[model samples]
Target chain A: MEEIRAEFSRIYDTYNGKIYRFIYLKVESREVAEDLASEVFLDAWKAFQKGQNPEPKIKNVQAYLYQIARNAVSDHHTSKKFKTVSVEGHMDIQDTGDPVEEQAAISIEIERVRGVLKTLKDEYQDLIIWKYLDELTYPEIAQITGKTEDTLRVNMHRAMQALKGRLEPGVTPEPVLGT
Target chain B: MREKDIIAKFTILKQIEPRQEWVRLTKQRIMGVPIHERFGFIDIVSYPSFFRISNLSYLVRKPAFALAAFILLLAGGVALQVTNQKLQNGLSLAEEEYQDTLASLELAQAQLQELRVAVEDNDTEKVSLAVKSFEERNAQASKDFVKLVENSSKKALQAGMKLVQLQKEKSQLERVLGTTLGEEKNEELENATKTLIEQELSDLENRTLTEEQQQLFAEAKAAYDDADYATALEKVWMLSQ
Candidate 1:
C-alpha cells in the first residue's frame, strides 16, 4: 500500500503540469480543464489500484495519463457543452514590466495565432500542441497516440504544413522549423 | 511571421497554469490517503456507498470465506437451473396446447366446408352430420385456445383473441347457411355468401400479414376455387387484425 501511494505521488507530481497544459489548450474554460485534469488523475489512481490486484501493471504511466486526458477531452466534446472563452484572458503572457503598447500588441498577436490554431482540424490541433507546444518527440507522441513513429512524423509534417498555410496564405516555401 | 517565430509563440501558450488553490485541493482530494487504508473492509462497512463488490480480494485470501462464497454461488446456480427447468416445462405444455387448438380449428373448418357443399346440393342428411361434426370440433378448438391463452405469456394474448373472433365469425356463417338451406337454395343466398367471402378476402389482404399469413392467403384462394368457401372464410377470419 505504501509503495502504491509513493508510485502514485511520483506520477502525479511529474505529469500533472503537462497534462493540465494539454487539457487547457483543447478546452475553452480553465475551470473545465482543471476539473477534467483532476478527473484524469482520479481515474488513473483507481485503475492503478485495480492493476495492483490480479491485473498486469501499466508499463507506461506517462502515456497512460495522456490517454486518460484524451478520453476526458473527447467525452467533453461529444457532450456538446462546449463554450469558447477568450484565449487572451487565459494566456498568462509574461509580464516583464513592458510598455502598455507592447503588451497590447503581443496580446493581439497571440489571439491571432490562437484563432488560426482553432480553425485547424482536431487531429492537426492535437499534433501541433503535442509536438510544438509541449515539445514531445515523435516516439513519445506515438506512444501516447498508439501510432508508429513513421506515421507520427508524416502526420506532424502535414499538420505543420496546414498550420503554415492557415497562418500565411500565398507565402513562398521556407525551410522547416524543427527536426 | 517566420516558422520559428510561430513555433515560439505557440510554445509560450503552455506557460498558463491552473490556480494554486485548485492544484492543491485536487491533489489532496485524489491522493490524500494511503492505498490500503483508502478502501479497506472497515471503510466499506462504515460507508456502504463506497463498497464495490469487485473489491472482495481480501475475502478471497481467507480460505473459510472463500469456500463459503463458492458454496453459496453453487447453490444459487442450482436454484436458477431448477427454476429454468420448470419454465421450460410450462412453455412446452403451452406450445402443445396451441398446436392442438390449431389442428381442431382446421378440422372444424373442413367440416364447415362439407356442410356448405351439402347445403348447396340440398342434401339434408349430409348437412346434419356435417353440422354435428363442425360443432364438436369448434367447441374443442375454442376450449384448447382458451387454455393456451391462459397459460401463455401476454404476447400470445392478442393472437389468441383474434383466433376466438375468427371462431365466432365461422359459427355466425354456419348459422346463416343453415337458415338459408332450411328455406331454399335461393340465388340471393348464394350471392350473399359470395359477397361475404370477397369482402373478407379484401380485409385480409389489407392487413400487414406475416409470411405464414401470406401462405394462408394463398391456401384460402385455392379453397375458394375448389368451391370450399367455408374454409376460405375461416382462413380470412384467422387473418383478422
Candidate 2:
C-alpha cells in the first residue's frame, strides 16, 4: 500500500501540469479545470488502487492520464459546472527582449492562434494540442483516443488544415505535412 | 502565415499552465500524503488523520471551524513531537551498535588493504602482523555484525556478513593463494572467496571512507528497519573497503 501511494505520487508529480493544461485548454476555466483535473487523478487513483491502472498493466502512463483527462473534460462539458469561457480565466500571455520585442510579437501571435484554435472543434483542438504542442507520437495518441494510428494521422491532417485555414487567409489547402 | 508559422503558434500553447498553488492543493486532495513506513524526525508537518489537509480545507474555510482546526493542529503537533522524542530516545541502542559496527568495518577495510600490500611485498612478518590485526578486526566486526544483523532483516546484511566471513576465510585463502591451494576443494573455496570479496569491494574500496557509514546505518535502522537493508549493505561495503 505504501509503495502504491508513493508510486502514484510520483506519477502525479510527473503528469499533473500537462494534464491540468490539457483540461484548462479544453475547458478555458481554471476553477472547472482544477476540479476536473483533480477529479481525473482521483479517478485514476481509484482505478490504480483496484489494480486497474491502464499504465504498467498495458503500456504508458501518458496515454492513460490523457485518456482520463479527456474523459474528465467530456464529463464537465455535459455537467452544470462548466462555463462557456470565463473572463476571469483569460490567459495572461507572458515572455520578452528587439529579441524582447520579437518575443512579445510572438506571444501576441500565439494568443491570436490560440483564439482561432479555440474556434475549431474540440477533437481538432485535442489533435493540434497533442500533436503540435504536447508532441505525443501517433501510438501514444492512439492509446488515449482509442483510435488507430492511421485514423489519427488522417485526423491530425484535417486538424492541421483547419488550424492553418484560420491562421492564414489565402493558403493552398494541404492535408499532409508532418503526417 | 505560413505552414511552419501555424504549427509554431499552436505549439506555443504549451506554455499554458494552471496556478502552482492550485496544482499543489489539487494534488493534496487527489493524493493526500504518500505512505511512508513511519514519520520520524520533522518529516510531515501534520499527524496522520487530523492533518489530511485535503479533507480539512472546506471545513477549515468555514467561519465556525477555523479556531477548532487551529486547536486540533496544535494538539496533534504536540503529540507528534512527544512521540518523535520517544522514538529518538529508543534509537540509542541502534546508534551505538551502528557506530561500533562502522568503526570495526573501517578498521577491517584498512587492515585488508595492509594485508594486500604485505602479500604483494612477500613480507612474511608484515603479512603475519597485518593478518593478525585483520583477524582481530574481523573478530570485532563479526560481533558487531552479529548483533547488528540480528536487528536487521536485510538480504544486504546477509550478503555483507558473507563478505566479512569471507574476509576471515581470506585469512585462510590468501594464505593458500600466498603459498598455494591444498587440493581441489580448498582451491575452489579460495577462488570463490576472492571473487565475491573483490566483486563486493569493487566500488567500495575506491572511497576515502568516513563517518557517513554510522549515520547511514542509523538512518537505515530508524527509517526502515527491515526495508532499507540495501543502505546498511552499502555501509558494510563502505567498511569492507
Candidate 3:
C-alpha cells in the first residue's frame, strides 16, 4: 500500500502538465482540455487498478494515451447524434477580439485542412495526422491505428501522393523563373 | 514533395480548433470519478465496494492511511537530504586527502632533483646521505600518492553510483507524480526540475574545477623542482580536490 502511494505520487508529479497540454491542444479550449485531461487520468487509473497496462508490452503508454484521446473525440462526435448544428448557430465564433481572431484564423486554417482530410478515408486521415501533426513513429502509429508497418508506409505514400495531386495545381499554377 | 502545399495544408488544419467546451465537459466528467479511479493510485479508501463487509474497515481507514503516507513522504525527503549531505562531506574529505598526497609527491621529486644535482657537482659526500634519506621519503610519498588516487576514484565512483540511484528514484517518483494531476497540467514542474539540475550541475562542476586544478598543478611543479616529492604529491592531490 505504501509502495503504491509513492508510485502514484511520482507518476502524478511527472505527467500531469504534459497530459493537460496535449488535451488542450487537441480540444483548443482550456475548460475542455482540463476535462479531457482529467478523464485521461481516470482512464489511466482504471487501467492500472485492473492491471491492464502490463508494462506496456504491446503499445507504449504514450501511444495508448493518444488512442484513448482519439476514442474520446470520436465518441464525442458520435454522441452528438450526427446533428449538424447550423453555421448560424455556431456562436462560439461570435467573440472576435484580436487574440480570439488570431486563434480563429489558425483554427480556420486547421479546419480547412481537416475538410480536405475528410476527403480521405479515416485511416488515411489518422495516419497522415499522426505522422505529420503528432509526429508519432510508424510502430507507434501502427499501435494506435491498428495498421501494420508495411501498410502504414504504403498508405502514407499513397496519402502523400493524393494530397500532392490535390494541392499541386492549386499551389503551382505558374512556372518558376529558374525552370 | 511540395513544401508550400504541405505548409498550406498544415496552416488550414491549424485553423480548425476543436470546441473549448468539449475539453471542459470532458474534464468535469473525468473529475466526477474518485481520485483512485482517476489514475490507479490504488485508492483503497474509495474502493470499499469491491470488498465485502470484511474490508469495510480498511476503506474507512483512509484518513489514517493518508496521514501515514504524507508522513512517509516527508521522511523520505528528509532521508534524501541527509544522504546528500553525507556524500558531500565524504567528497570533501577525499579531496583533502588527495591534495595532501600530491603535495608530498612534489616535495619528493624536488629532493630527488637536488640530490642528482649535488652528485653531478662532486658534492656526493655531503648529498649522498641526503639522497638516501630522500629516497626513503620518496617511497613513502609514492604510497601516499597511490592511496590518494584510490580515495578520489572511490569518491567519484560513489558519487556516480548515487546519481544512478537518484535517477531511478526520480523515475519512480515521476510515475507517482504523473498519476495525480490531469494530463498536460504537470509538465511545467517536471521540465523545471530537469532543466535546473542539468544546468546547475554543469555550471558548478566547471567553475569549481578549472581554477582549482590549475593552481594545484603549478604548486606541484614547483615542489618537484625543489626535490620535495612529498610536497609535490600533496599539491597534485589538492588539484583533484
Per-model lDDT: 0.65, 0.62, 0.50
Candidate 2: Cα lDDT at B152: 34
| Candidate 3 Cα outliers beyond 4 Å, as residue runs | A1-41, A52-59, A70-104, A165-179, B1-4, B11-241
Give TM-scores for every candidate, taking all chains together and pairing residue i with residue i: 0.44, 0.46, 0.36
Model 2: what is its DockQ?
0.21
Regions of model 2 farther than 4 Å from truth: A52-59, A89-109, A168-179, B34-241
**Between candidates 1 and 2, the lDDT winner:** 1
Q: What is residue A19's positional error in candidate 3, in angstroms?
A: 8.5
What tens-digit string does per-residue lDDT give for candidate 2 at A1-179?
Answer: 66778888898888887888788776655567778888888888887787744435625778888888888888877877455556442442332212323444565665566667767677777887888778888888887888999998888777766565566643333422332
Q: By DockQ, who's the top model here?
A: 2
Candidate 1 lDDT at A89 equals 52
Off by over 4 Å in 1: A53-56, A80-109, A168-179, B33-241
Record all residue pairs in model 1 with backbone atoms less than 3 Å apart, i.e. clashing.
Answer: none
Judged by DockQ cut-offs, the docking class of candidate 3 is: incorrect
Provide backbone clash counts, one per model. 0, 1, 103
Q: Model 3: per-residue lDDT, tens digit, B86-141?
A: 66886787788766655655665566556556545757464545445554455445
Arranged by DockQ with the best first, the candidates are: 2, 1, 3
Better of 1 and 3 by TM-score: 1
Model 2, B113-216: lDDT tens digits are: 78778777878777656756765676566556655544432322444555445455565656654432111122222333333334444444465545775454
